[model samples]
Target: MQETVLFVDDEKSYLAYTTSIFENKGLRILTASSAMEALEIIDQEHVSVVVSDNEMPGMRGLELLAKIKELSPHTVKIMMTGSADLSTALAAINSGEVFRFVVKPWKKSEMLRAVKDGIRRHRILQSLAREDEYILHSLAQTIELKDASTRGHCDRVATLALKIAAELHISVDRQREIKYGSWLHDCGKIGVPEAILNAERALTPKEFDVIKKHTIWGCDVVRKANLSKTVQDIVLYHHERWDGKGYPCGLKGEDTPLEAQIVAVADVCDALTMDRPYRKGLCRDEFLRTIVEMQGTNLAPHLVDTLLQILERD
Candidate 1:
């Protein structure tokens, strides 16, 4: 999304003047007559930078910016007032609410410089986020290349899991974490021998033990990266069953984190639907029947029902 700025000032003349200066400069501007109005716009739109006049009626600039810090913490805030009070400026800076303070009758060059600097800060943050996503997707594709597995296994799992998470009414932040977990659920397989991963025959008892250790290895890998705990849980526990017979950790029932449980169902669904070296993939009708019978045994019963709701809808 492009970086956008909002101007909140009680005086119509100043609001117009602030917006006019940035016109034809590739800057998108939104204006509000009061602090409350500014907040309403913020709630509905993505405002990258907010320049507000402090002495407004109803809600003041500092109070509105404080609320913005809680609501959209990354948005850059600038305090504008005709009077220059060091105390107010200091308070805004110390609280980490305002990025810059501008005096009234400001030089056009000074305001422009401040706004551009704020935009640069926002762009840096956005670029880092994109880089993180690229690294995750690249890592997932590399993992898939190790074994003769389904095409884009991690991507499919993430798509399916996110649909179920949405159906479960999970919060948006958690949904993002779920996506990350889905992509790296089997990351531990990086340590497993390729020969064991591609074996046509059922794994021997000792071989299965090595396979089970992949979860531990993957969790350790994720932990070292300092990822969120939710990501670690999904990597560590995606194989865990609803019954007390999973692996590494035989967590039963709700003992498994919800994010892990969602990814677990998604992983199994993909494995059954896609062709493997040992067996042909199941048709939709057959797969549905088998998984229906598997509810409460191999997977969480409620989560299985949730998955069914998403699949049937699609």
Candidate 2:
């Protein structure tokens, strides 16, 4: 396959120098002296990797990377800067805008290696996106096998979530995202020890902390899988509460992604109504009562109402 890398820098000399270095490397190289020019090229070509300079005039590399993320999420972004700083690096990484950070005066071999690795990562992402639906469904089921008490939990959640999404009248694409996210929401639990998951006794604070880390672990699991953003959001934030008392990020109210908020409601309801080693499943009446009590606190208020309406009709 032909791999095309786009290098964006305001300095014409830097662009020319890098172009010369990689000219005979058997890879297609495209250069842009500004962010706008780079975007134009991107619109016309299928770029594999984008290596951008952070301190460009008009549009900073970080800003351009953000736009590229929105424009072509599959394109791998790499940030290269002469004036490297911790803040910039953290921002790029936390936002998931850049795949790699390279200093401006990087070694020729090291830069080449990073670009090659970025291309490989991009290819992996594309391949995962093309994975058959059954394969992904199987992976979700395999994740559930790690916890015996929760067999079919993901499937139930996906069904319930899809219902809620439809009731909410969201787009079909969003509905699909909700379903995919529900199925893979607890995939991070694979990182938790079986003993901890199956413990009938109360969990110690340390043990609970370990369990909470499952969301992060789950995010890491799907990070390389190239799942859609909505799926990722649900997997990472499904445990977050609406009133700001949740784990990981403690996002409050509408600050949490709507998809995550919807999944949180479905997840808790499913868990409450399903059998567990620690407790028996809540009956329908008990489940409804418990959810009503939890509304506006642990779960989204509107979603609670929506779920109630759904159950009432069912």
Candidate 3:
């Protein structure tokens, strides 16, 4: 519950001034006069919020905050500068690199409020992330009970999707979102009835119509849970075919989100390996052949190739 804020600036006066303002506010205040020095401090301690000056020598504040993102993604970033530019501020906020952009000659009230908001945001995000871990698996488990055949399907799909994402060199944060998305891609199926889901015979078009509504329902569930857009997209769009022939929406190739495409490939890979009431599971070689053939048809070709390369290496 102890919150720490690091202030980075080139001027010793600004560092002292900021520290004086917050020292008695019941918050831990740490300061560094240069961007390099701030990074050193960050490397050794947990920083809850970072208030950085933009014009520091050797490394700019925006660049430093970018590094902070890699070092501690949950840390809130605030950019302060004397020479505030519209373009830089807009881009940083848009890209989620900066939580607040404060002018150097900020009023005491402004600085205090910005830091307060930053801390609150950081706490909320951290709390949600912590709590959502159980929520995701609980939902996945409940979804699995709809059909005994899919007991561990979500975990298997998530593992394969993560591997494909890694092969594509995705950033750590994005990969985390991909993992969440993969785990809940079929979450909407929770709304479907067990009779249809566990049917021994092939599905009728009307029954399939009821089945396809899972994406729509699943997306709604994720949205209400306050998940990232990346997670919601995967849940809704993973069922979309690469050529646009498959799905509730019939989204065409490349039109679908990349994360969704990656999961779709993973879904097919795992689904083919699992025995259904109607058909036996495919052998590894047969599965590989089927995936290769599905390239650019039912699944994205690039992701399919990425999965193939990963499999080959293993």
Best prediction by lDDT: 3
Compute each candidate's TM-score over C-alphas: 0.65, 0.61, 0.71
Candidate 1 achieves a global lDDT of 0.86
Q: What is the C-alpha lDDT profile of model 2 across 1-314, one tens digit per residue?
A: 88889999888888888898898787899999999998877756678899998987899998898887754667899999765475786777887878888886878887889898998998997787557456778988998887889999988988988889888876554676687788889889888999999999889999999999999999887777877777788899999998899989999999999989988988998999999999999998898889999999999899999999999999
Give the runs in model 1 whose Cα sits over 4 Å from its true position: 1-123
Which candidate, 1 or 3, has the higher TM-score?
A: 3
For model 3, how does the per-residue alpha-carbon lDDT over 9-107 read when each residue is reduced to its tens digit? 998898889999997788999999888888777766678899998988899999999988765667899999775475797689999889988986888
Q: Find the candidate with the highest TM-score and give its number.
A: 3
Ranking by lDDT: 3, 1, 2
- lDDT tens string, model 1, 146-226? 986755889999999999988887755567778989999989999989889989889899989999999999999889986
Q: Rate the local accuracy (lDDT) of all candidates.
A: 0.86, 0.86, 0.87
Model 2: CA > 4 A from native:
1-130
